[model samples]
Target: MALLLKEFSPAELDRIIEMAWEDRTPFEAIRHQFGLTEESVKATMKAQLKFSSYKRWRQRVEHCRTKHLKKRDDSITRFRCSRQRAISGNRISKR
Candidate 1:
């Protein structure tokens, strides 16, 4: 089900967009707080942001700084919690 949007303000929407665009932010952050999935976040971004901005954000993430040890590809790496993995690495989510 789609998350209800009634309580959100423009400021909150902007915050969401900023968090989504931030390389350090995680999908789990939005998922935990707002019950939004990655797909939902993407849809929101597309609907609320300019096409050019969205494109740039996506490109930035696709070329983000960190690399995935197992995957060996930064572009495909998913930002997630470090506790889930035995090896120490940049955890996508934080307490």
Candidate 2:
């Protein structure tokens, strides 16, 4: 996992964490963007978050239909909100 940590910059990791926490961002999306599998993302979240928070996150994600591509609706193609502010040069701006 240290090797995986080395692969991402602090900003990238932050982005990954943010994405992981989003209800619509599936594990496959994280895998596609960062090469981290669902398990890896879970591990990273566990390592980064407090134990209770991690437990709550796990409970929330465990059965969330939107967190897995296979379980998500076919019509949903994008993970982010259409009204979401743009991200530029690693900085996410509010609308």
Candidate 3:
């Protein structure tokens, strides 16, 4: 997992971290975009975040039903918010 994570640019890593933190962004979406499994995403978060932050993130993820595709509502189809504009150059456009 470390080697796989190494291939990402700093910006990509940041985006992965951001997506992991989003309640509605499932692990499948991260895997689709970054080729990381749920375990690998957890590893990336553990490696990149402080211990306290990692713990909090884990707790939050465990409680967030939307973070896992199977647990998410079928009505919610997209990985991102409907209000969010297209991403350009790795940056999500500001409203």
Q: Tell me, by lDDT, which candidate is best.
A: 3
lDDT of each: 0.62, 0.86, 0.89
TM-score list, all predictions: 0.58, 0.84, 0.86
Rank by lDDT (best first): 3, 2, 1
Clashing pairs in 3: none
lDDT (10s digit) by residue, model 1, range 23-49? 655666667656677787788888777
How far in Å is the alpha carbon of 80 misplaced in model 1? 13
Candidate order by decreasing TM-score? 3, 2, 1
Off by over 4 Å in 3: 88-95
| Model 2: colliding residue pairs | none
Candidate 1 error regions (>4 Å):
1-7, 65-95
Q: Give candidates' CA RMSD values in order.
A: 7.9, 2.6, 2.4
Q: lDDT by residue for model 2 over 10-89, one digit each (tens)?
A: 88998988988999888987887778899999999998789999999999998789999888999998877887877554
Task: Please give me the total number of clashing residue pairs in predicted model 2.
Answer: 0
Error of 3 at 44 (Å): 0.3
Residue 58: error of model 2 in Å?
0.5
User: Which tens-of-lDDT digit does each residue in 1-95 have in candidate 3?
Assistant: 66867799999999999999999889998888888899999999999999999999999999999999898889988777877677754567776
